[model samples]
Target: MPLTPQRAHLQFGVVLLAGALLPALPLAGQQVLSVFAAASLTEAFNDLGRAFERAHPGVTVRLNYSGSQVLATQLEQGARADVLATADQRWMQYARDRRLLAGDAATFARNRLVVVIPRANPGYVEKLQDLTRPGLKLVLAGAQVPAGGYSRESLRRLNGAPGFPAAFDRQVLANLVSEEENVRAVVAKVRLREADAGIAYATDVGARDRDALTILEIPDPYNPIAEYPIAVVAGGHRELAGAFIALVLGPEGQALLATRGFLPPAPRR
Candidate 1:
């Protein structure tokens, strides 16, 4: 007896339905990991989150990116975040000093401090020494911001350097344009030519949609290595948070950081 074509089609359809239904049971129970990171990590972490979603189907990622100081303040004020990645260890230390972070954190990336100038270069602030030129507009991050702290230190070093103090007084200190609230704001002002130049992270400058700014690298003799650390915030989603941290420390995450103009995490000294 020849089985009818409709019966054959119905049998195949039933088999397909069962196979599709079998995978749906586990898809509905996936987890979500939330991370609070610095603004500079906007690009890299967003990419990491997407990659993570692809690797772990059904799991979702929620990211809050802002200034490191602001994020730290949020954590202290009881924000719920599984992972907290800071721009520098100082902020993380503050979180730990207050018992905000649960355990030891790992350094996940390093960034270089670079001076950004407007494409217009109206004041002709072209070199590191020119940053201190008198009457040339300049912008810097506020004292609490990581880039500000680094810039202040760099200026001190320049002032102390033999034959450099004169240059610092003439270019950097004299120009004295404005002090910004954060690194991102500093970059933005310079990109808009509101100020002649500004100090910021290389990664920050690289993130700008328009490449209208010129970067002046701090000479090696006075350059400070900037590093970022990741820690788990206490009382947040610790397990999944740790998973996110592990992902940042993993090969895939490191690769993304490198692609975004950051130096890979170095071996502990």
Candidate 2:
């Protein structure tokens, strides 16, 4: 029998109907990896996220930045995330203790604490010891924050130094006007002149705020190094999470972190 136009049109219609009846599938390689990271990593991680997306087509990187402790609590409460990056080893250890991590956390970067004052020099704060000046308003991170813990440790080490008073730490604590939730908030308080001075990570004063703040480097002896650790969450996208970690530990990520003032991870034994 010879093929006819009417029969051919009917066959095409049936094919279209069958295609429409099938389940719709996602595009190949399309995936989303949600990352819960420390607030201090905001800038660097954002840049890294973009870079990772560019390198891996059809993949999206979602970032949630907050205090390390805050993020840990969220994970403990069952928030869905593929990876967790913390500003300190303690929080990563906290996650490990709760069985939230798939493997051992890897240290990715390190940072140091610094004293920042408003560009106007409102308190005549030229040295670290100046934080104890009478009536000076000092801002710091909340005691639970990694940056805050480092700040307190640094202040305690500064106390009783050659020129500092015996009760220097006590006096500085007395002058605290605000305890912010994160290091960036402390930077903002000082940058906007809301407080006379604040303690923050050295990287907190980036190029944008360099003109708005004065950064005073803390001596090594009195400074505490903040170590960053990253791990894949137990029930999230494990393969993608590993890939993201590789990018972060690779040269490009390391270079980007260094450019943002973060120190390279300490040598592994």
Candidate 3:
């Protein structure tokens, strides 16, 4: 039977409509991978997200970035996170205790602690110990941030440095103005000159305001080396999450991290 032009047009339209809807049908029904990571990983992980999307066109990688402690809390509350990257091992352990993490955490990056002061150096804290000088407003990260823990450890080590700790204790107690929620917050207070000095991660200080603040490098032995760990969340899109983790640990990811002032974990340690 010869088909009329009107019928032929209808058949072509139906075929085109079916083809257009085919690609979305399976994806619309598939699950998306949600990832929770530390705020410090924002820039690097964003790059990783784009790379993951390019590699797995059908999978979506949703990311949440914040303090590691906050991320841990969210995971504990049963938020669906396929991958969790923490700025410290402690949070990973905490998550593991709750069985929220899928596998043993792998250390991906190392960070350094630094004392940052306003660009003008109003406090004259040229060295770490100067942070203990009287009347200087010093801001530190709240106890929850890994940077805060590292800062406390470094301060304790400094205490053993010939009256440094006593001076620091007295000065810090007197001059302590604000304890921010994360390293970036602490850095911001200093950059804005709201606080005379602040302790923050090297990467956090690498932000654009770096020139607005003077960075005081801590000595190697006394400084606490912060390690960032990566793990997949159990029972939540594990395969896709694990792929994201692998990408983070890969060369391309590490290179991106290094450029942002994060150190790759030591080969032997």
Error of 1 at 55 (Å): 1.7
Please give the RMSD to the true structure for each candidate, in Å: 10.1, 9.5, 8.6
TM-score of each: 0.83, 0.88, 0.84
lDDT of 3 by residue, 67-140 (tens): 89999998898787789999899999999999887778999999888888899988888777777677888998
- Give the best candidate by lDDT: 2
lDDT for model 3, on a 0 to 1 scale? Answer: 0.84
Give the per-residue lDDT of model 1 (tens digit) for 1-269: 68799999998999999998997676466676888888778888999999888877778888998878998998899888888888888998999998998899899999888888887898797667766666778888877888788887777667658657644634575566777767888988988888988888888876454469888888766767788999998987787778778888999889988899889888878
In order, the Cα lDDT scores of the candidates are 0.82, 0.92, 0.84
Consecutive 10-residue window with the lowest summed lDDT within model 1: 165-174
Q: What is the alpha-carbon RMSD of candidate 3 to the true structure?
A: 8.6
Q: Tens-digit lDDT track for model 2 on 38-140? A: 9999999999999999998888898999999899999999999999999988899999999999998999999999899999999999988888888999999
In angstroms, how far off is 37's CA in candidate 2? 0.8
Runs in model 1 lying further than 4 Å from the true structure: 1-30, 166-171, 207-210
